[model samples]
Target: MRIKYKMVLLILLPMLVVIGAIAAIVFVQEKQLAAQQTLVLEESLLESKRAEIMDYVSLARTSIDLLYSSGRNDEATKEQVKAILRTMNFGQDGYFFVYDTQGLCLVHPRQTELEGRQMWDKRDPTGFPVIQKLIEAAQQGGGFQRYLWIKPTSGKETDKLAYAVLLDRWGWMMGTGIYLDDVAAAKAKISQESDKRIHGVMRSLAVTAVLAILIVVACAVAVNLSEQRSADAKLTAMARRVVTSQEDERTRIARELHDGISQQLVSTKYQIELAQFQLPESDENRAAQQALEKGLDGLGDTIAEIRRISHDLRSSLLDNLGLPAALGQLANDVAAHTGLEVRVDVSRCQHKLPDTPAITLFRIAQEALTNIVKHAAARQVDLLLSSDRRSVALTITDDGRGFAPEAETYAQSGGIGLRNMRERAELEGGSLHIVSQPGHTVLLATLPLSEAG
Candidate 1:
């Protein structure tokens, strides 16, 4: 996979996982909390319903008390009390009933057929004696009871909440009830609404999570692309510099040959022709002796120029005497040319290195020496080469008036030399580091040794 894709996964996978986990946890917890709240709300509402039942029963008892206190204690008054309770109605299935302690129905507003009938053993669908339980509750000073009973409006057996109280003076059990399914319906409605709101919240969080992952992926891609562009630009510039450096080297070599060796060879050739024209006819060997001698001197100068050019291109001594000898020669030449105190120390690198690495290190040292000759004002220079079983290192130290390290720009101060040295070190799988301060500058190159090289 491409690095950008890998980075996107690396940046987003963990974030998405955490978000998903948190969302799941929140959703589950919210649903659980909603269920709990529904139960609490149902209880609160059921309690209020139970209170309404008590009030209805209390009003019926008060009406009976008023009739008794009015001194109307007769069959007529009893019938009147029954008429008042039968007419007391609020909603569907809302009414009062009166039964005797023996479970005989006396006044049933909605079910008049069961009036004056013995219902002491009447049981609901769940096998509870509904009439017996209601009679007991009334005789025990009014309380609530839950059971299945016939709903007057629907004419079907449904769960009911009833409250009852005793009429001690009349041996009557009077009570009223409300259907339980109404409360259950309210609870169901509340639960449905809660689920809708919770689901909405979960969806919003999911969208937020997805958007967050997209943002992270976008940022990662942007960073990777930026880095890739920067790398490409650097490679392009380095390639251009390599081509320019090669041409510059070729031009320098051409100039040296044309100005130094080529001119001297032509001069030597003319001198030889002149000597031939002035040859001693009698074999005295003195007529053209000066011309011949001057030709020989010219030939010597030409040979020296050729040798210098060859050394500039590549030193034969480097292949023969190895890197240590080559570096020592370089130090000597630099000292001769620049009048600088130069030291070559290679006591620790006696082992011969591979050919390519040896050449790279030599070139780096050459470039450093050239830079010091051209730029550094102070004289003393030290070149050290060392090696161990795993790696080899070279250190070039010069006590010179140094340039401002921070303010130094490769373009402004001639970057080619430094760039070439660094590139050479990298080609050999080595690294180069430079530290410079006032009157002191150090350049170090370290190359690891592999089994093959």
Candidate 2:
């Protein structure tokens, strides 16, 4: 994958994992809560069932009292008891039964046919004191109890919750309860809801991670394209400047030869012919003397002009004497042209350097000094030429009315050609640095003699 994708994965993968874990935890807890709430709801339902059963049995005892007072405690009362027993599912999550003061069942919801069916000197469903205890409580004051391990049915196991109250007259005790089945249903529902919510959270996290990855890739692409375009534009501009400089150099050479040297040579040839015509052919001594003198004078002037042109075209001293001699000539030219004091320190450059490095250094110095003469308009210039086994460094500092290099519109134009000097150094795999401010300008060029020519 590209680095952008890698980075996004690095950042988002961990976050997604963490979110997934948190979601799982939340889901588990939510499931637990649902289960607990279901249990509570079931318990509440069982309690309501207990209350209804207790009320019916207590009302039956009141009915017994009413029957005795009205003298009808016979056939009609038994039918009423049978009807009450029919209302109970003896072993659902709920159960109910009834017993008299003699510890015998008057009505059993399940085995109602055995109406007198209990041995109730007995324990409650939880194995504690039951009918007899409630009767004593009714004789003393009144209170209730809650405990565990209650077994109300025989020949089978019954985990029961029973509430009992004392029978007042003929003696009776009653209670009702439901098993814990309802609690389990509530727990399952909570688990399902929690699972759904956690999965939802994980899905959301995954989406966010995907979005982050896409954003990173987009930014990386934008930066890469922008940088590529910028580099291409710089290269194009540099190429154009190189071509322009080459054409300017060719035109300059042509103009100098045509305007300065060709016309001078033509004029001199005409003058020599005129002198020949003026000389008398018969006076051999005077003619020979004047002709020889005129020829020597004209030739000397022409030779001087030719040498100047040659230097302008390419420093002849570079071919004849070496880099130092060429720089010495440059210093002389600068002093002559600008009326500025020019100084050169060539002691460090005595040991010859690689040819390309020497040429690049020379061109940089030549361009800098020329610019100082043409544009600096100051009194003094310092040129320091130095070299080592690895590289050569030349520094040209001018005490001049300096111009801002970055602001110099004419650097690539006619006024000062510093840009050309920079390109020359760069072409030779070197750098030229310029530090200029008001009243001071320093140009330092370092070319690697060990590497570049």
Candidate 3:
């Protein structure tokens, strides 16, 4: 993938992970909270149901207060009280029942077949003794009990809550009950609504996370496009500079040949013509012989100068024997021309370089040496070439009166040469660097071996 896409992913992946974690935590916490709220609502509804049943039982007891408070223990009075209770029911599935202390059914408005049945051992589906528990609560004044019983309306076993009071004079337990199915329905509705809200929140979070990732991606793509344009501009400028540098080099060589070599050839040709004129009067003319010898010497010097210029244009050693021999020959030529001590070291380099990098290194070395000869006035110079499996490096160091590399004057004076050398290395996917102080200067160029043919 391109760098921009990679960067976008780098930003987006972590955000997605964090957002997903937050969503999960929120989902879990919301579910727990909904469960808790449902429990609280169910308890509240049960409490209301308990109070309502207690009120109904109190009203039934008050209706028989006049007869029971007269201290009567007659069976007729108990029968009259049972008749009133059988008719005092509030709604469908709501009523009161009576059981004697000996567990005999007396008043059961909902199921009249059990009016005189013995019911002491009656147990609910979960092994709870329903009549025994109600009697126990009534014996201890008044209290409540919870058990399952068949509902008249639905004819199905369901949870029920009852309040019971003891009628000591009649030797009976009387109580009323309310089923809890409404409270369960209410709790289930609340839970379903809570789940809907939670789902809505999760969807919103997902949309927000997607928008955030898209924004990051768009920004990365914009920055990448901008950088690409800038890089293309720089490449164009560098290409132009390279063309200009090549033209300038050709111009310099042409000027040297015209101004220096052309004048010497004219001088040598005139001396040869003068020697030919004196050769006709030979034997006694030592001056004519000396003139001929002088002409021959000048011709020899002219030929040597032409060969030096040709070598400068392109080194035969570089093409034939490789970079090491080329660099050694360059050092020897520089030392001979300038009387400066120059040493070439390739002892630590065994890897051979391909043409592009080899030529780049040679050109940078040539430029650095020319700069050193022209500006650096001290004694000795060293040219070191080293290589490893991955890359090759050429370092040129001089013990000379160095100038500040960053100074405006220094950069302006030799900026073209320095830039040319740097550009050459960069063109080969390499780099050039220079460091200079008062008595030391170093120019190092490095190129990758991976680009080699």
Candidate 4:
């Protein structure tokens, strides 16, 4: 992928992971909290139901208090109490029941057919002994028990909550119960509402994540556009600088030829004419022979000067002997001209670089040496070249009064030479780095050689 897309993924992947984790955490926590809330609400409602049933049982007991407190254990008095309880009921599915200590049904207001039947082994759908547990609760003083029973209104087995008490003298267990399908219905409603709320929260989180991703993508696009524009501008400027530098170099070479070599050639021509004029007399005159020799010597010096200028324009050594030799000759020339200590060290390179990379490194070295001569006030310069299988590197070090590598002038002012060197390295898929302290400066350039072969 392109760098911008890679950058977007780099930013977005982590964000997506974190968002997903947070959403999962929120969902799990909310679900747990909802379950807990439902449990608390169910307990509260069941407690209220227990209280209501207990109050009903209390009222029934109050109604029979006079009879029971009369110290009568006779069948007629028991029959009268049963008649009163059988008629006292709160709702369609609410009624009283009575059983003996042996688990024999005595009074069942809702199901009269169940009266006078043995109920000791009667079990609910879940195998709970309904009559046995209710009789036990009555025997052990008044208490509540939960079981399934036939609801009077629906005539279906439904959950029921009951309170039971013992009439000890009568040997009877009296109880009343309320059907509890409403509690189950209430819990189902709560669960349904909780699910709806959770879905709303999840939707909100999903929307937020999408919006966040969109915002990040938009920002990345904006940054990419801005960087592209800036890079284009810099490339244009660098192109202009390159053209200007080329023109300036041509102009300088032209002027040098005009002012130095052209004048010397003219002088040599005049001397040759003088030698010709004196040549006819050379067999008879020693001065004529001397003039001819002087002219030839002058011609030789002019040829050497021309060769030097040609070498400066484009080194023949670089084309014929490769980069190492060219750099060594350059070092020699610089040291000879500037009277500065210049050293060149080249390691045995196993890989030969292609022309562009070789020339780029050479030019970088040339620029670095020029900078050291003009600005660094250096006494000694070292050029080191080494290569591996993958890349070639050139490092130039100077023992000099070094300037700040981070100085703005190198980018903003008359520092095109440094910029040109860096641009050259980069154009060849390489890089240039400079490090400088008070009395030491180093310029390093590296170019990859993988594509050279």
Compared with the true structure, all predictions reach lDDT values of 0.76, 0.61, 0.79, 0.78
**lDDT per residue as tens, model 3, 349-429:** 898778667767877778788888899996899999999888999999999999876675665566356766777777767
In candidate 2, what are the lDDT values of residues 1-453, reduced to their tens digit?
A: 987677666755665575567567756765675567567656655654454444434333332332333334465764564455446454444445556666676655655465766655566465676556544544453333443333334434444445555544434554444443344455566567756766775676578556645755566332224635865676667665654564455446546655665565556556555655665666534545454465546555654665565566567576567788888888988788667899888888756766556666776777777777777887888888887767778888989989877755857756328787787777666788889887889998887765333
Q: In candidate 1, where is summed lDDT lowest over 10 consecutive residues? A: 282-291
TM-score of each: 0.44, 0.38, 0.46, 0.48
Root-mean-square deviation per candidate? 49.4, 51.6, 49.7, 47.7
Candidate 2 RMSD computed on C-alpha atoms after optimal superposition onto the true structure: 51.6
Q: Arrange candidates by lDDT, descending.
A: 3, 4, 1, 2
Clashing pairs in 4: none
lDDT of 4: 0.78
Top TM-score prediction, candidate number: 4
What tens-digit string does per-residue lDDT give for candidate 4 at 1-453?
Answer: 899999888878877897788678868876896788679768967875885687578657755765676677888998999999999988777888999999999999889999999999999999999988988898898888998999988889999999999988888899998888988998898788878877987897799778878977888733224645865786667665654565455446545654665565666567566645645653444544554555456556655666566566566667678888899999999999899899988875656667657666776777778778888899999988889978899989999998877676864444456767777777667888998897888888988887535
Off by over 4 Å in 2: 1-303, 451-453
Error of 2 at 445 (Å): 0.8
Q: Write model 1 residue lDDT over 71-155, tens digit each, in one string.
A: 4558899888889989988787799888988998998878899998999999989999888888888777788889998887787
